[model samples]
Target: MSTGRARRALWRWLPPWALDAGLVALAVLDAWINLYDEGTPLIWSCVALGSAALFLRRRFPLTVFLLTLPMTLFMDVAVAPITALYTLAASTRNRPLLAGCVLLNAAASTLAWPLSDGFAGDQTWTLIQFVYTLATATAPVLFGQLVQARHDVALQLVEVEEAREHERALHAQTVLARERAQLAREMHDVVSHQVSLIAVQAGALQVAAKDPDAREAARTIRTLSVNTLDELRHMVTLLRASGGKETELTPQPTLADLQQLIANSGIETTLTGGLPPGISTTAQRTVYRTVQEALTNVRKHAPGARAEVRLWHDAQHFGVTVTNTAPTRPSVALPSARHGLIGLGERAELLDGTLTAEPTPQGGYRTELRAPTRPA
Candidate 1:
């Protein structure tokens, strides 16, 4: 049990308190070995003063060095405590102070060797003795400086890793947002074209039931259905192609496409105002989707009801309002994800714009979106 206790104590890294206690123990042992045989209280008192100085070594290093300087005159090995001065200088990151302390300890130890009692060496042997003493005394402080430099390097590496992780997370979020926007554009293109053809064919079929003068209109409906299916198949092919071919070098729909959208829906459209040229592509795409969704909802949910898409623009602002009237009792139920309005809200916020959707006073839905013409 005693051996195990000794092993555990030796294996542990010493805390500041433990290291200070060790320094005090070493000081006591040195005083007992070096001054007791001389039988003088003055030499013992100097050892006591030097040992007590260890308590303030971390707080005031220069003061500790000064107090230990007088001890070199009495004992040949008395300058050993000045090594702690260099250790403190390294810990505090004071390069000039550490170098000064090293030089002072070397000079004092060399001068005291020849003057002390029982000294019989010439200058050559004395010089050799002083160089060995200086190197041994300075080793602990050099080791301490190396430890401090390694610790600083480790902290810098941790900071760099954290910064890299933050950048990677930001890049992932940006890629996800771009993918979602691309999906929204593709969905708008596919659904809008198919539903437009269906509405046009149904409207033409209704008008041609009683007239012999309507064969051309019937043929137009059939042609539209076939063309819509062909376009849909081509869209599917585009989706499976390598390298996002659907997105690259393809003509994007803009405000000009709104008239085509309305004509294909069999809804008569009137243009009163022009859209601003300075609007960003993202905002224009969002505006196009909002108009497209609103018209599709009118056709599916209010079969005979007409829709009005109004775009109003000024110098610094633009606005869009899509409204439809109440349909008959036999109106069809529209398929909806209910996420359109929320998605519109998010898109408007990205452009620093605003959107509002509410029930119209005439018993239908009205969606209004507004944005700045210039980047804000």
Candidate 2:
């Protein structure tokens, strides 16, 4: 249906022997037509030469064009000579050579007609020969050029489509990578907070237990929880690697502009402390994330519980806490991934900090975060 596919099919279906036989038959038919129309052996011999050249045109196009030129002067209207010129023009685009052949055909036809018998050197007869030569000799070459142009455009279109397909595939791969890295970060947050909480609760149990066996079991639980959290962090680090967010945070929010964060959070929160200047950007970012997660947890687990946010700085570390009073009525279950605190703990660890979350004895929740003021 399409030119490229059709050409491929033609190549597959036609053997060289069959194709050569077809071209030879076409040349003979053209030679016979000239022979019948002229009925002159001299003119017919010249026309036959042009037809015979057809078989070699594919291998020697310019030779075919030159060889067939003298024959155009022999016959008044020859198809074989025109076909030779067409094949040459279509195959090779040597403009000056083709122009010379066309001009020679016109000049020879116009001038040689007078040399024929029954010609009284009439200007009108010469004019008719010129028009016929120009039309018959040049028309086939023009048609060949048109076919060549169309073929070039078709090839160019195919190349452009292939380039676009390659670009699309690369774009898809980039998007998939970004999504995977984002998923790793989210998983890290959930896993770390939950595991850290397990460690903390077990630690408290170990401290309060009186039985030696109970204390030892509690200690084992805490150790396992901490060890598991360590392994999870290592796995997440590998997964998030090469995605720049693995090493440095973007859209970093700091404590200086934290009031806006608190106001927009839709929670009644207070800020009482500020960090002194010269704190590293990384630690400040960790502080910002810790506070945000704390407020988020307060809103989730203690709905309608008036919350208080406190911040303080010592020579070694800066501390943040979000504490809420006991809820009047039990908070309704909200759709939650409950991974916010895990992410928070990891963020604190990045800054040599600790995140502790627990139930207050008064039936409320408290989340505390501490990060080093100086690099460790």
Candidate 3:
């Protein structure tokens, strides 16, 4: 097996033209050795035509084999006829035509060139010679057919591999769709119900509270809970639609919603600057999320802090910066997975952008997002 592979590798390194030239040289040498003695002008001419015809064997195998037959009848030259017959056998699928070609080659080799010389032979000896030549001619044909079968099997294996890969991809997509549907059901049935209760309870507290501070805090809690429910509903809708069915989705937040977001944040925030008019919807959403996450973090970690949201854009880039003052009061620690900034960073990377979050020298915190104006 290793030796056959090495031989095939070597053959592949040789160019097609070089292989054809080598075959032509081998056929010419065979004709020269056979017809060296008993050489006439007519016989030499036949040898020249037969040897040259081998160059076109791959393109016109049957014609080249017929050209070599004339020389075979006049002289004992095997290389040209055998090579031509093998090429024809490998190229054609017609078994009857291949058998006819084998018979013609054998007849040409068995009979003498002149009609009188062939007739003068002993009939039994002539029949024996024909049988031997017929058997010899079939060797190249059988080998050629074997090579052709190996090539066909290699192509079939490649097609089978591609089909398996396609099936695997389809299976993965089906599994992902099923998981998304299950998640949508849980969010709608569990999370939405709890947040709705929180909103209702806060509204009732705001109506009944006698102290102004207590009433104001209850109103803020009610507003935040309602906003959370709206976002949760949108997420559930998207997850359920992951199966590729067209469903109307709630309009996503954009730059126009930035002011309302800051107002309802329950933190003192200032908004300034603006983005260009033609920016894509995806970029707008990225900017909105940046400010939203930054403000939420300030509220959680920097209690009683004032935040400033600045949106800026030039010819090349556009982004938002949310800076917060140091907290006036200590904050209550909240459970967090710390995946918010990581998700924001990934989102920015998808649009060829960057996100930076760090503490300021004066004990404040800053979060900024920068993205290309025209994403590829």
RMSD of 2: 23.4
| Native-to-model Cα distance after best TM-score fit, residue 83 in candidate 1, in Å | 5.1
Question: Native-vs-model 1 lDDT?
Answer: 0.64
Model 1, C-alpha of 346: deviation from truth (Å): 14
Report the Cα lDDT for residue 81, model 3.
90
Please give the CA lDDT of all the candidate structures.
0.64, 0.69, 0.83
Candidate 1 wrong stretches, greater than 4 Å: 1-15, 39-42, 78-83, 113-121, 188-376
Full candidate order by lDDT, most accurate first:
3, 2, 1
lDDT of 2 at 203: 100
lDDT digits (tens) for residues 249-331 of candidate 2? 44556667678788987677777766667677556666676677676566555656777778878888787877878865344
> Compared to the true structure, candidate 3 yields what TM-score?
0.57
**Model 1 lDDT tens row, 151-216:** 766755654554355345434534554565566467547675666667577567757667654765
Q: Report the lDDT of model 3 for residue 321.
A: 93
lDDT for 344 (candidate 1): 61
lDDT, candidate 3, 273-339, per-residue tens: 9988888766787788788778878876786889999999999999899999999855544445555
Deviation from native of the Cα of residue 239 in model 2, angstroms: 4.7
